[model samples]
Target: MRLSPSLFYTTNCEPALAFYEQCGLGRATILLRWGDNNMPVRTETMRAKIMHARFEGPGVLFHASDNDDAEPMKGSAMMLEFDDLGRMRRPFTRMSEGGRVTVPLARQVWGTSFGMLVDAFGVQWMFSCSNE
Candidate 1:
């Protein structure tokens, strides 16, 4: 089975989507707005809110949505493994903007270049690539 993680943004899905795109993930697709569907409640104010979105690329596939009650996850992290150290730089730089770096990119004893950071959207990410 193929597993795709879903990310729920409390209110900033647009920026989050853009941020991921900048990190080398493909553009958002299959966008669904809240008011586009027939619901019994008033959704005019939420018409611009993203009810669903999909982001897919060479090494990523995930769903995203704007949620009012969504809370950021703190302990867990999303780790991305790259084929080589060169492939890890650009995305690492882009994803680290305005974010706190818990572990700077460097050569690890395991013979890999690795780094960790919490993105501006409060998402934790670990980037790694084999040095071999």
Candidate 2:
């Protein structure tokens, strides 16, 4: 069995998707739109909303969709562990652009690089890299 964590966006998912891209995450393709398949758009907000999108990066994969209720995003946190410090640092710094840094990336006494932040979408993220 496999598991994929999905993120729920607050209304428009554009900002969240752009944030991920700036963090070095790969592009996302809209699998479905709220206005697709001749489905009726109940509200103007739904017309251009994404019903589903798949995001793929070097070693990342997740799905996201807009939270129709437009409520605050209080989703789960995600962690990315890497064998290369450079790869780990790139995204960490980019994610910090509009995100809240809980912990800046630094070499720990244990010989590992680690950091944490909450993205603009309110999703917490943890990044780590090995000394090797």
Candidate 2: stretches off by over 4 Å: 40-42, 70-75, 109-111
> Which candidate gets the maximum TM-score versus the true structure?
1
Q: Which regions of candidate 1 are displaced past 4 Å?
A: 39-45
lDDT of 1 by residue, 68-108 (tens): 77898667888899887887888898899999899999999
C-alpha positional error of residue 44 in candidate 1 after TM-score superposition, expressed in Å: 6.1
Residue-wise C-alpha lDDT for candidate 2, range 25-120, written one tens digit per residue: 777865567788886676777776777889888888889887577555455578899998877888888887777999888988888888889886
- Each model's TM-score? 0.89, 0.85
Task: Give per-model CA RMSD.
Answer: 1.9, 2.1
Span of 10 residues, lowest total lDDT, candidate 2? 67-76
